[model samples]
Target: MPAESNMSTHSDPQSSETAFLEMRDVVAGYGNTTVLHDINIGVENGQIACLIGPNGSGKSTLMKSIYGFADVKSGTITVNENDITGRSPQENLMAGMSYVLQDASVFPQMTVHENMLMGGYVFDDDSQAARRAEELYDEFPILGDIRNQNAGTLSGGQRRLLELARALMVDPEIMMLDEPSIGLEPRFIEDVFDRIKQLNNLGTTILLVEQNAQKGLSVADRGFVLASGEIKFTGTGTELLNNDEIGRLYLGG
Candidate 1:
């Protein structure tokens, strides 16, 4: 394993004590290859926390580990004070967590309404799913206008919007977003960031893995820097952005 970055934690101790989501001393990875080392991070209720680092810094792997897609070698992951390490994705969803994957994840052949319905498939009743779909339509008018159109016909930004809308069908309390702004035009990228802010305002605790470090930190309540599969820094977003060494090393200052 590589040496961990020498950085101090700047998290508010009180906030961490009451954090709704937390990973403590985690070591995780894919089959037989450890990628994360003694990692720790936390997000208070309804706060937007961003993970920013160089490529292969275990950012996505942390999210994957939380969602049970990666193998956890040790440590614990918790939500609302409940242990959820190694829970299946479906179990996590039922526990009020939702994960929005990278790239376009909609069913391209399905109509907008169909794709939305699929998001609520976990509901036991089809009628409940339909009601949730209607609620999402009201929340996203563009989706309503194109409810019958094929998902593949939409532009990149629109498809991204659709993915976000579908993810909301469950009204998850905690949302994990992986590269929400990837492949988007400048205008669309700004729009997506605005949407993410809107979602956070509506009380969804957000854990974001973004390539746009500056923009991501701008919207984040807390920021974490991962290097060599370990946390190099943890602090309020502004602290990291303004810190001389952190800014020069990670934010391309």
Candidate 2:
């Protein structure tokens, strides 16, 4: 059984020259080799901000660094004007932010509902955790229908959805998703994308790392193009799509 989380406070944000998340002059990577260099990004409140680039472009590395999974050599990561760089994973998780890593993210042996419980494990009250799980199930009915099924046995898309349900267990105001469409069949891809928007519509700011460029931009309110760990371009998703150079260079024009 998992404990209940305190999700009473949602992160209030400012959009005027203010970003809920900002990474400035960031240079980080594995032990000694740096993958991201002088990276800067800003995500405002209630938006789907996406990062897209070729493989090895440090997209995932940047995401991990923001979540405190990668090593940071220089820079700052802030959420809502508060400094949060180098915060431990649990620290970030408890600060109204949650992560749903690519596919293969859930506890394979746990029941669907059990996995939801695990997501809110940090909460101190068991009753609170239980209530949160019930709420998540209602938000995601697929999981509700298969609450007792082993998570490992669900289809690729179903598992991805379940991971999202778990992330909501803590009622996070921010979600960082990494390549969620991986291993999913084409038909359910749209559903996954739609759900991502639904999360944002409900007030969960999203920082997304997606491989499918066109699809990613379609849902993104803002987009960043990363090259060799540096931001090459930043604009509204529509602006990027309409740019002659950006379309030819990145969007399969």
Q: Pick the candidate with the highest TM-score.
A: 1
- lDDT for each residue of candidate 1 in 36-119, tens digit (9 for 90 to 100): 999878889989999999998999999999999999999988899999999999999887788999867999999999999998
Which ten-residue region of model 2 has the weakest summed lDDT?
Answer: 1-10
TM-scores of all models? 0.94, 0.92
TM-score of 2: 0.92
What is each predicted model's overall lDDT from 0 to 1?
A: 0.87, 0.83
lDDT (C-alpha) at residue 82 in model 1: 90
Candidate 2 Cα misplacement greater than 4 A, ranges: 1-16
Over 4 Å off in model 1, which ranges?
1-15
